[model samples]
Target: MQMTVSEVLARFVSETDFSALNNDNVVAAKTTISDCIGCTVAGSATEVGRIVRRVAQSSGGEGKATIIGGVSGASAQAAALVNGAAAHALDYDDILWSLYGHPSVTVLSATLAVAETEGASGRDLIQAYAIGVEIIGKLGRAVNPQHYEHGWHATASIGVIGAAAACAKLMRLTEKQIAMALGIAASQASGVRRNFGTMTKPLHAGNAARAGVFSAELARDGFTSSLVAFEGEFGWARTLNARTVPDSDGLQVMLGKPWELTEPGIVLKRYPSCGGTHCALDAMIAIKDQHNLKLEEIERIDCDASPFAHKVLLYPRPVSGLEGKFSMEFCLAVAAIEGSAALRHFDEAWINDPRVQALLPRISFNPRADLEPAISADAVPAEVTVFARGQAFSQKVLVPSGDPRNPMSTADRRAKFMDCADGILETDVAEKLFNDWERLDQVAQLDELLSPLRPQN
Candidate 1:
């Protein structure tokens, strides 16, 4: 009998072994998990994170799952909701190019919630996360560009399914149940780019994590959904469109041959803003440095980027910090003035500063017509031109920092972890936790490290 997409996904989830993952992929998963933990911890301190945590805690049911920096032991779904929101609250979570969304938060938030509830070992967490990455990466190849072009936020729409797969694997669900879980997730998948610069964006991540856990739990208890929910007539593919959908044959051929985590892998974010703005921001910073630009000397700046960048960086004159993140003009203008787009730099004061406001009109996006037909998301080529001191300085960045080709170093990653952990943890505790994460797969219990994430009574 021929199987459906969900069946194939379910079997892959049920059959893949931890031993199938090589050392490098395992290390990548560990780093992603660690980074997510830091992001979640930092996010828990945010206004949005606090609001969600309060709601979760007020729900009045409790389990063993950790809520990052909140009190320990919320129910698994509640923990997933809070931690997932926190992980993405700062827009600092790791990203996967193929997936075209934030991958780590969805996977880790759901897996850890389930792991804690089951007292699952670290190896189980690692294995489950690896499978989750594979699912999202493969599906990204199949559904995105078209799906993304249509304005679906793959982070939530695709991520919910990926999170469900991870949780199902960790829970040791049967193959049939896994298929049902994915079908259930299919109905729940939804988010859009219109909410990019608001609390709703991170909330999308949280919703995916929560729905993923709910889907798997429901399926495990014999809740039924279509086995072919992914490729059926009324399923995800046709709903998306007939012309653009997952390439089933392509995905099956590539499943684990070259693990997604090892090849194109997740990119760790260096800035606390939309990934769409990174390349241009990097170019503008480089140009500013090379020209020794002064605020007074600058005349105007010009930028050209991938058309997708144009679509994402929609805020031309942002009035708020969140809106500023999706504005290339604002990001570049700020980088030109501040030399860096650090976590502290994104605030109401920065948005309203006269220097930033003045620089906004000076920088403009010019979409190159030549590259329009051939643009792809992975290679977001950007050009920055600065007319300052009567000289034109130009720089182009084909690959932004933190991309696998131009990867963040171990020291850089650690520094980022420390930066995010600043208010949440003591320096010593933060350092120790990072070290522990390096050996996470070898640990006997997942809680030893996660327990520290709870607020001290």
Candidate 2:
């Protein structure tokens, strides 16, 4: 008999070991993990992060896992919820094109929570995270574009399964238990694109992470679920994904073939806005620097983006910071006026700035089907035309900075970490934490490694 999709993934989770990872895989894992930690720490200072931590502390009771920036720790599930939300709150986490979502927030959050509870080594955490990302990326290949176009938020909908697999791996669950966990996670899978600019957006990631830990833990203790949950007539792929079903055999063959981390790779975000705005932001910033053009000198800025970018960049004139993250107009305007779109530029103050208001109406973002055929499948192309000083200057960017093809340097990554940690942690403490996390594979105990995440009196 042929194996089901869940069973195949469970077996992959069961069999893949740390030794199978190459140097590149380890480096990617470490980089993504450390970057996510920075984002989480930064996000923990946000309103949503504060709210979730309070809720988790009230309901979760005291447990083993550390909640970054929380006054106290919570259960693994609760900590995953808090950390996952924080990781995505700023929209600063890494992105995987294959998954069409922020992969690290879900996978790393659940893995870290479970790893701490299980007293697992850093190598174990890295192995689990890589395996989870691989599973998510392959599944994405099978159902995405269709799945995403159907209004599902892939980060939460797909991430739940990846998080379950990673948590199951960390907990050393058997293949059967892993399949059961995936089935349980499938039932919990849900997130919609309509909630893009709200607090519910980050909550999607948190909920997925929480559900993943809950599912894996339940399966380990004899929980039962259908092994064929992903392919059953009333199952995840069939029900959630319209007109598309995953090819289990093909996906199994492709798993870890070249490792998604090394091939297509993760895109570490340089700016703290929606990924859709990134290409345009890159182009606009470059044009600003090259021409030394003042904001007032520009008459109009036109950006032609992919269908995907047009769909996700929902806000035109945002009224709040969260909404600003999804506004291509706001991002480009700030990038032009400020010369860069940093995390600080997405606040309400910036959103309501008179200069920003004046520039907002001058920027236009539209979907162009023509750009789709010109670039690779993974490329996010943005053609920016700036009409300035009665002259038109144009720049088109296929791949923005921080992509594997055009990677960020070690210093740049460290600088991002420091920037994220600026207000939340003292400089010395943040520096030490970044240094320690860089050596993640060598850490024996997660507790020791995460000690600095808790705020000191």
Candidate 3:
């Protein structure tokens, strides 16, 4: 039934009832929202955020939603664009390993902007967010991660579908409308890996998020798009993928799997660099702690990652901060020299440091096949070694700290929230946000939660 976008989207949304959601679903929704809020605030204070904010405001469009951490509010679409990019500015927003991508940054950035403008309650916001995250996760899994290998940005491509589903669900559209929204989103889906390590990479995420919202709104107003935008012979998979892609029914397999944030799930980063580099950082930090080797004593460092991991990291020379985050060379250099990829490691002078630059050549990568990556392999794996003062030390990190394997405790999440909210909000205000999100269904007004985000006098 070659239905319109709104018709299709509404149909799918009607099938997703929040009250019936399980505990994991609820928790995923809550943490992702809180995580995005934290990342957005942290990103806003960065130089990249400052620069992008000015550009967004200067190109002013409709004043629909506020761009958190920006110079001024812009239209919903514009705000989503800037806010989404900023949330990931530190390359530390959060990661959903299930999807092998970043979701909350894209889905929530647009969803939050729209929810605030639509006056939706916190409960409404979380429901929409879960739908978005779920949809993106399913879509990414369906694609079998080939798209990423083929150089398409999953966060942007799959994220567009998620945002559309979210917007359609939040707007209370019908199953048909929801399906159509997916169609509309398919048309707008795009993002490339070539832009990795650049502002444009995150901007791609912002674009996908904002575009999905726009697609949904248009669909709601009787807009139309291809009915089989996802499955048609000439549809998304065929056009975007060079090899065989997952069948449409593949989407149903994990469409509503137990919430992805709970177990064997999303990896909330404790560091601000590429997830690929985490195992190496994990190894290096432990070595530094055990031996207390001065940076001068370290002759060289070595990291072993799967071929795919090497492709993502292991860049020989990095000229920018974005590149620095993914550079095994750069990240290894910092971890050995500075002990962490904290904000301080990203300073301009530090990025170009003579000592770090000198060590770059000594840093090399060992590429291994994913042969039984772990006790039970989970996609990514690595082993790192260090040679310092005639002693060779090595460690293997099957999963990083934030992985569901080595999950962060709730208290850890709370501490992170507190850190992210420090300068912008007091403990009481942040506490309110953490507590209220759970009881959002009973909340009347959205202002209580949104209050902390407003610019102070």
Candidate 4:
């Protein structure tokens, strides 16, 4: 009999050693992990982060894992929940187009929690994270853009299974137990795009991270679930995805063939907004800088984006910072007026500014079938046309900054980390954390290295 999808994935999770990873894979894992920690620390200061942290603290267990900026620790599950939300709270976490979602938030959140609880080393954490990204990326390739287009939030929906696999690996679960964990995680898979512009958006990551850790722990204690949960008639692929494409059957052979982390790779965000907005933001910012166009000279700005971008950028006229992150109009307007859409530009004061209000009406975002490609290695391309001073300045951005093709410089990544860490951690402390994480593969104890994240008070 053929191995089921869940079993195949579990076997890969069970058998693969950290030694199988190459230098690039380790570097990729370290970069993404460090970036995620910075994002988590920064996001922990947000309203959603505070609320989730409070909830996790109230529903307590033995405190075994760090909660980034919390005063103390929580259970692994609770810590994953809080940290996952914080990682995505600013919408600043990394993205993988293969998953069509933020991958690090769920993967790192669960693995870090479990690693701390198990006293796992940095290499162990790196191994689990790599496996999680691979599983999520392969599974995503099998079902999306159908899965993503069907109103499912891939970050939460597909993320739970990947996180489960990561936690199971970190916990040293058997292959059968790992399969059970995937099965349980498949049952828990759910998050909708309808909640995109709300607090519930980050909660999706939190819920997936918590459910993943819980699923893995349950499976370790002999919780039973159908091993064929991913490919069965009423299973995850069939029910949630409607139908898996032909590629779904071939995923078993494809796992770690080249390692997902080193291939298309993860897209670290240049702006603290939706990934859908980055290409357009890049185009707008470029046009603004190239022309040195003043706000008064600008007549109108129009963005022609892929169907995926159109669906994800739902908020046209946003009322708050959270909504602003999903608004193409708001993102572009800020980029045009302020020359950059940094974390400081998404607040209520900026949203309601007279200048932003004046520009919002002049910006138009539309979905054009022409821009939609049959296959894309990165986020779909976007075309921006800015009309100003009786002249049309048009730029089509095929790849946004932070993409592998247009990778951010080391200085840029470090700057981003420092920017995210600015107010959340003191400068010297943040510097030490960044340097330590940069050498994560050399670290002996994961929790000890993360000690600075806890509040001194």
Per-model lDDT: 0.85, 0.90, 0.74, 0.90
Off by over 4 Å in 3: 1-10, 62-64, 71-74, 242-244, 371-379, 418-443
Instruction: Estimate TM-scores for all models.
Output: 0.97, 0.98, 0.91, 0.98
Lowest summed lDDT across 10 adjacent residues in model 1 is found at 370-379
User: Against the true structure, what is every candidate's RMSD?
Assistant: 1.5, 1.4, 3.0, 1.3
Candidate 1 error regions (>4 Å): 247-249, 369-376
RMSD (Cα, Å) of model 2: 1.4
lDDT of 4 by residue, 257-303 (tens): 88889887998899999988899999999999998999999999999
Better of 1 and 2 by lDDT: 2
Per-residue alpha-carbon lDDT of candidate 2 for residues 1-457, written as tens digits (9 for 90 to 100): 8888888999999999999899999999999999999999999999989999889888846678999898545799999999999999999999988888889899899999999988899999999999989988888877877788789998989999999999999999999999999999999999999999999999999999999999999999999999778888899998887436876788778999989888789999999988888889999999999999998899999999987787788889899999999999999999999899998998999999999999988988888886662222476789999999999989999898999998999999999999999988889988998999999999988877788899877
- What is the C-alpha lDDT profile of model 3 across 333-361, one tens digit per residue? 88888777775576567779998999999
lDDT of 1 by residue, 2-97 (tens): 767888888889999899999999989998888888888889999889999999899877888888878776888999999999999989888887
TM-score, candidate 2, is 0.98
By TM-score, the better pick of 1 and 2 is 2
Q: What is the lDDT of candidate 1?
A: 0.85
Model 3, residue 54: displacement in angstroms? 2.5
